[model samples]
Target: MKTFSAKAEEVEHDWYVVDAEGKALGRLASEIAFRLRGKHKPEYTPHVDTGDYIVVVNAEKIGVTGNKEKDKMYHRHTGYIGSLKSVPLGKLRETHPERIIETAVKGMLPKNTLGRNMYKKMKVFVGPEHTHQAQQPKTLDI
Candidate 1:
């Protein structure tokens, strides 16, 4: 038995849809991270990028437990002598709902090129409507 490695191949990929409405942010991100890393597939290869596409809908409705929405902060710097910026989770959700989920899942993934590739497969939308209807994505029960 050979273990699967993280490599890019020309195999067919499936598309899955997840509704983020009323779902916990961390829980949803874990499931998406699993699928994105191809852990749910029978032919899962640690060194191969065999993940499927994930569409997250209603991102604005995703919830965070406790007071994270207010206390949680995302920070970034502009590469300057004292250029630091931080945004609260609650504000980010209102301004950019998709980013909340994206950030959570991205953080849970491996920090490497393979992880970046997997991150690209995740598509998050603020509302229930999305432009990926042509792919015929199946609803994921997460």
Candidate 2:
């Protein structure tokens, strides 16, 4: 039998919604990342984007275990000397909650263009509502 390799046009993508309410940040992110990479599907191909779209809502409600909420720090820098900045996880959840899930899922994906393409399919929202109703996404509990 010939080896099966999925084609780009043959990939069927679906939209899924994940509620981050009271869910652990790492676990939730990993689950979504797996789906985003299509790892859960039997026909997943490494070189192709066989993933589904993900919509994460209520991201601010995601939680951390132990001291991660306080000890964890997110770092960023501007293209200038001594322009680095950092923020604790707690503050980040309050000010930029959507990034909590986004950063986590991004880290779990491949660090390349393929990853970027998959990352773009992940929609994150701070509240419980999203505008992707037209796609009729199915809700997934992480």
Cα lDDT over the full model 1: 0.90
Off by over 4 Å in 1: 1-7
Which 10-residue window in model 1 sums to the lowest lDDT? 3-12
Candidate 2 residue 123 Cα shift, in angstroms, is: 0.3
Which sections of candidate 2 miss by over 4 Å? none
Please give, for residues 39-59, the per-residue lDDT of candidate 2 as tens digits: 899889999999999999999
lDDT of 2 at 8: 84
Task: State in Å the error of residue 69, model 1.
Answer: 1.4
TM-score of each: 0.93, 0.97
lDDT of 2: 0.93
Q: List the residue pairs that clash in candidate 1.
A: 4-45, 4-46, 5-47, 5-48, 6-46, 6-47, 6-48, 7-47, 7-48
